[model samples]
Target: MKRFPGKTMGLLWASLLVCGGAAAAENFEQCKTRLFNQAVAQGVAKSVATEAFDSINYVERVIELDRSQPEFVTTFPSYYSKRVTDWRINKGRELLKQHQPLLTRLEDEYGIPKHYLLAFWGLETNFGSYKGKMPVLSSLATLACDKRRSRYFTGELMTALKLIEREKLSTDAMVGSWAGAMGHTQFMPSAYYRYATDGDNDGLANLWESIPDALTSAANFLNNLGWEPGFRWGREVVLPQNFDYRQSGYSNRQSVSQWRQAGLTRPGDKTLPDSEVSAYVVVPAGHQGPAFLAYPNFRTIMRWNNSEFYAIAVGKLADQIAGGKGLSASLPDLPAYSRDDIMQLQKTLNSKGFDVGKPDGILGPATRAGIRDYQIANDMVADGFPAKQIMQQLKVVQASETSPN
Candidate 1:
């Protein structure tokens, strides 16, 4: 009877797989036909649309990209070190010099500083050396069909079609990131629609071939995102002993006086006289690392990529392009552990009656909050950063609580 049941289950699984494959193929065909008809209705030649759609297949790479995945995630230090190193800095400086007039014009127009623009150039594509190796249409189509983020990817895919229709780009030339972000600055198709500008005035904002378009478009994006003219993003600062960890996160509004009252002080450089603008405090590595008082402009930078590390890396890289020194502080000292170790640590904490959120390997905010709760219960400093010492202590606590004496 058991063998009979196993065979039935195997047949059911095989049938389901076949059905799913057929549905996906059907969906792709429907999407392609709809797109071709729409293009024709909008005056695009039927032959052109047909030719473009003929070879486009649903690419599998887009849905598989999660940097936090086990094979992709890496240490923050290593990540930033490679991206904001001497080579990038030097290249940015050369580009800055080479394109001073255009940079000046962009700065004047958008009020976004030139360094920030060039920094994006360096970071987004390493000065346009490799602007991704994916087909934009296929990638978008695949991700749009993916169950995870279908809505968002489908919207972007439609936006890409609009770009092709407007003659802003040709189908054959729309290669980009597997996630459908294209050109030198990795602008998603929708972003290109909204913020892209023709700084070179060749009638189109061609970020693919024109240097002016990429830099100016980036500046325009920042400007539209609320960058204040003649104002700095944020200055590096030192937190006094016993800084409040709870109050630290990205901020768009905190008066300079308020921060100063809370013991945030910029070392060496005198605080520029701008006391009215709101700012938020950021301490990337808990309490032990260097801190900064991020202004509203900093939040604007964060809008480009909602990661503290990404924003700070861009800010720091911009500073490097502007002939500023490297970071004046270091990261909090913590023993680096792999994903498996962190998962085990989380499980141990959970078994010892401390709810450390899910025992997933990712060390996100909830996990940090749980660890902090555990630390406070055990009379340890609530730094939140995981380390060898904390993991060992957790083990000891778990064993003591679980031992059947």
Candidate 2:
């Protein structure tokens, strides 16, 4: 999958690329025709567009993977364990030394640290061990013909065609996740079009083949996403026993000194950095879980992946690879939720007048806020995390809800 929720282009640019929102109802052949037309209309040469179409087909598995994307399904521990492993950290440390010269240059030029770039690489494609094997053209085309995200995927499909024409890449080697995110860092075609760099002086930015090119392109993307030079992503903190959970969360940002005054301290009870940097406290696994005071750079990580779980995983994995202390608190064993379970929670919350704004199974500020409000109203802890107890109270799950098979 690609980094999502980034502002890749303007509404006008997207509108220009999209002409097939209603193509879902049409047969694959018909939708394919519309897509080829849209690609040509967006300035992809007709020859290039036709060649791409000849190699594309509707992939049933792509649509299945899209509907059940791990982003919408996995819980924090499940996501973290799989992503921030010892192998990735150990390998990343070796890579840091192996590519020292290039990484240093990239940091000097792009202001993104080597560890962060490496962290993204480990998380995105396991340090290039597996850069997915799905056919990119077919994946994007299938998604473009779907009703749910046609406009967005249609735009990506058109850009993928442009990338092929520009790079003269073979469709066979241009494989990626079912979502059409390509190469080592899993960049969508739009991101590829914008930030790809020719780091190896190969006269092309081939993210799939050139390690230098992929790393440099990743650095460029992070810099564009607002990475701050010489700043840490965030740090784990020990919250006061009587800390008010309501004050926790991204929206309720406060100065570091203010948080220090409010009894937040480093993991060993050391005083905070004493800076006036604006920061927010995030208890990703809830009040019982660990806490981190997120900084501006943390939001920059979120731009790379809007999911708080993924962002935190990136930070923790980077720290581990750098020989930093791991989390002070062990992750509590929690039940993993399927989309249907979350949808049920949303429906239940709406019935009680929380109005979570139509739950699409993805956890966001609205759902967290709704859960917080509901908890407060019912005289429960207002940490905004949907623990199993709260789930039972809301009747979103059974007495023993386990993960989906």
Candidate 3:
């Protein structure tokens, strides 16, 4: 389910620009001026603050990207196929062997598996081949000045300034994603402060240029996030015919034994291993699609990236790198919805007294619950998937209301 933490920053900024006209730009400049003062108050050198902010322009592109993260809209199958490809897997394997010595050392020290590290490296920036080109300072400043998620981004901006001060990094050299996630494994500035490591012992983390530093920092981050050394991330499991669909998702967690007792098994009907480990069932594409019993380590992966699809991709990619089989089941051919459609759906559900909160175009938990309630009332499968059928049904109802009466 969708979970946007705040209002769309881009839309908020756009509305401000429209309402305030030229005043918006003036207000932004004023905001930047105040940010400079805040930086100085936070112990950033006045010269450093000036230098970082002087030539920085509000990167409109950054706002656009922040608003339209593909993971929010794309189906899991579409997203998964694009990321966990044959080339990536082959490259990951090659890198795994090439960096065996370094990975082995990291595993020994951090108690995290090597393949998972490779998976993160592969997925984050395509094995360091593309760490983005946007200036981190400008992107962070742009986002921090925006109303949405300003508190978080402002703190990140301060941390970035502190990073420059402590690490003695050139602001000009600090290039990364539109949201200011930097380096090979795309660590946010705060994360860089907390977990970045000098793997090569050259007195710098150097996630930009040093593979060892990037990979080591990744391992350290996961380890600090509580990565279990020996346990696998999770495994694809086959549910029993007519199994309860309500038992799926991260909320309905149970021990491995309990799930096995409830008729969950490996894809080939193999018995689950005798373990006391707790896991939750996740059916990303609903009951008709493939299911997985996500282990505790899966939660650890979620700490790295909160998205279920992303966590699954990393785990499955790592599995492939470790010589495991690919997914046996295919994704169902379900019709996709645009953001506007989702917003309309939420609005319609709210009109029907479903209480979907604000129609923010995000299918969050509340929206899903509303959809499920609607489905249950209409005697449909309450999967909360928001498929094309629901959208069409809503459209027909709207048409009826708007027609001559």
Clashing pairs in 1: 253-278, 253-279, 254-278, 254-279
Better lDDT candidate (1, 3): 3
Q: Candidate 1 lDDT, tens digit per residue, 307-370?
A: 7777778888998899998877775445567788778778887776767777878777777767
lDDT: worst 10-residue window of model 2: 396-405
Model 2, 1-405: lDDT tens per residue?
654354655655576545443343357779899888888898999988888899998787887787765534667777788888889999999999999999999999999888888999999999998999999999999998888899999999888899988887888899999899899999999999999999999789999999999999999999999888888988999999888898988779999999999999998779998888889999888888889899999999999888778889899988988888778888888888877778778877887888899878867788988998999898888888888888888774332243364
* lDDT tens digits, residue span 98-195, model 3: 99999999999999888999999999999999999999988998899888899999999999988887777888789999999999999999999999
- CA lDDT of every candidate: 0.78, 0.87, 0.87
Pull out the clashing pairs in model 3.
none
Question: What is model 2's C-alpha RMSD?
Answer: 10.1
Q: What is the C-alpha RMSD of each candidate to the true structure, in Å?
A: 4.2, 10.1, 6.7
Query: Candidate 2, after superposition: displacement of residue 263 in Å?
Result: 0.9
Please name the candidate that would achieve the greatest TM-score relative to the true structure.
Answer: 3
